[model samples]
Target: MTTLRRPEIGSTPEPLDLSFPAMPDRLGEVRRQLREWLSRCGIGADRAYDVVLAVSEACSNSVEHGYRHGGGLVRLSGVVTATQLLIKVTDHGEWKSRDEPSDPRRGRGLQLMAALVSDAVVTSDADGTEVEFRIPLDPRLSS
Candidate 1:
């Protein structure tokens, strides 16, 4: 088993933390709960939805590829700055990038993530895979 360590962001970031079993059926609930959490915390609805979508994509990838639908853990954490919301999803599995025409169409999650979030980062090494997404959390949220 591999252990993944989550680095601490800067102090200017507000942290919202959550963890869930890597199950397909639970993904929707995760998104919904995150949405509510952000809303109650005074995050803008638009930015919250963007974060939810990006997180959903990342978690889905974990369920479909990281754990291969068997079982694993997905950790979702958010760091909100005055102008950005940084979300990180860590999975206890390795990432295998595909690069062939015949490659299973199973690798577009990152593409979708890139399109939905302001910034998307994937770090996969000996420890595990961690994907981070950022959403602008400017004064719009406090409006």
Candidate 2:
């Protein structure tokens, strides 16, 4: 599917579309790919790091909580526009809580995502969970 946002300069940077197995080991590779692309797109180092971290956390949640019956697909898709960096991490399995996480770590992923971005939304239903983050780019660039 085509990405919604248009980059301010030039035509637009091609969206990064990835579908990988719902496994933990793949996350590092995903972050690496995103970091390279973001840097190439003129994203500053600090913002790139925050985006990578938030995306990694979302992907980790998909593999750890979203899949249950068997292995599934985790889809990462989005593009960085002039105004914002928008990414979505979606899993094909419904979220099922396994056990309470440690006190210090609980809810930190979601919190960090929201703190880093203008908006962070996590939606879970029968199909699966989708964690979407929209981070304003220019503001971070100036800060």
| Best-fitting candidate, scored by lDDT | 2
lDDT of each: 0.69, 0.76
Give the Cα error of residue 135 in candidate 1, in Å.
2.2
TM-score (C-alpha, index-matched) for candidate 1: 0.77
**What tens digits encode model 1's per-residue C-alpha lDDT throughout 1-143?**
11112222333434678788888998888898788766655655665666678789988887766887378788888765556556788998765556535357556778778877747889888777899775654453243
Q: What is the C-alpha lDDT profile of model 2 across 1-143, one tens digit per residue? A: 11122234674568989999998889899999988877666666776777788789889888877775679999999877677777899987977553645566475777777766647899887778999887665533332
> Judged by lDDT against the true structure, how good is candidate 1?
0.69
TM-score of 2: 0.80
Assess every candidate by TM-score: 0.77, 0.80
The list of candidate 2 runs beyond 4 A from truth reads 1-8, 97-107, 139-143
Per-model root-mean-square deviation over C-alphas? 7.5, 5.1
